[model samples]
Target: GDSDRLKVGELVASLSYPFGRESSLSFGIISRRGRSRSVSAGFDFIQTNAGASAGSSGGPLVNIKGETVGMVTMASQNGTMGFAIPISVIKNLLPRLERGEKIVWGWLGVRVSELTLEAADKLGLSPAKGVFVNSVVAGQPAEKGNILPHDVIVAVNGVEIDNPREFTRMISGAEAGSEVRLTIFRQGGLLQRSVILAPRPQESGGGREG
Candidate 1:
């Protein structure tokens, strides 16, 4: 499990203490920075290629500067890839645990799809990059923010989104209650708007309210 430490670019190191002697070492950049798979009580994880092994459980996954980032929870079967819970996830839950706060994953209420080259061209996206809005939940932040169906989203918080996944990734990474700026290409022109972020609601829950 990650210490849930969400350091944007924190440097750290990983130390493995196996029952036997000798420690292994590997390094790579943090890939896919964002929130955890779940909202309520989870931390975003760091995707890495660090060599982690059995008996390395509860070990320290650090950054380049030796800061603790996470632990070795699981690894790829072929031993080619690895992942760790972000340190921030641990930090957030730690405080809440001490305070006895119960949390649940939430949703922001929007449906989106990847902008394929065809879709992008149809939407008038020059280089065929951006997220396409499929639908907006009624009364949700997206709807309230005036993000309508068929809008092509190209950027969030000044970060360009080349795919629908990137759009969700950017939004999920934002702090709740923060106003997120968006660059949307609608019908025929480029428009900018800000949407306040909220907890993401579960998809299974239906009938979106604006």
Candidate 2:
């Protein structure tokens, strides 16, 4: 059994066998909880400075309550940081993993770019934020929900969206067929639409947030 739920800034303990020192342990705060800005596209990472060294890969990252939150995946080249794949990602793929099936993320089918200051001002957005829709896949959830190319997505299920990556992170994390309310800015007007996310199929052309 393992834990999948955790929060940002939560205290965590890393159980490792650094340099074969069995029963070794290290402590650190969760420095970041969202998608890693450094990596292009992958699962969200739990960033920390927990001194994970050789022989630490696959070790459990437990919370202060001794609940596993993530598993150490890799270390930075500079040795100043460590990256862990959130247990939720693993939990979602476990069944497929057991069945020897390929894993895929949820798809929203909208190509988007970060909202630029120029576009924001022209679009009457007081602050430049969120992301601009570039295109929508044919017959996908976005097109069905009237998510157009010019629309700027401001929030998802009432959670404020800041950038393209964050938008992708939120949507991918959502369960397929789950209803999501999207708050959008279009032609100087605010609109809301509920969309049902779909599972991204292997080799399919699912749009990306840029």
The TM-score leader among the candidates is 2
Lowest lDDT 10-mer window, candidate 1? Answer: 201-210
RMSD of each: 6.8, 6.4
lDDT of 2 by residue, 23-142 (tens): 778888778764422111334567777645666678888887787778886676677677777776667668877999754456778898888899999999988778899889888889
Q: List the lowest-lDDT window of 10 residues for candidate 2.
A: 34-43
Number of clashes in model 2? 0
lDDT of 2 at 103: 49
Question: Which clashing pairs does model 2 show?
Answer: none
TM-score of each: 0.61, 0.66
Show where candidate 1 strays beyond 4 Å: 1-45, 50-60, 64-66, 71-97, 101-106, 203-210
Root-mean-square deviation of candidate 2: 6.4
lDDT by residue for model 1 (21-92), tens: 687565655554445433332234465556345655566677665677676655555665455656666666
lDDT of each: 0.62, 0.73
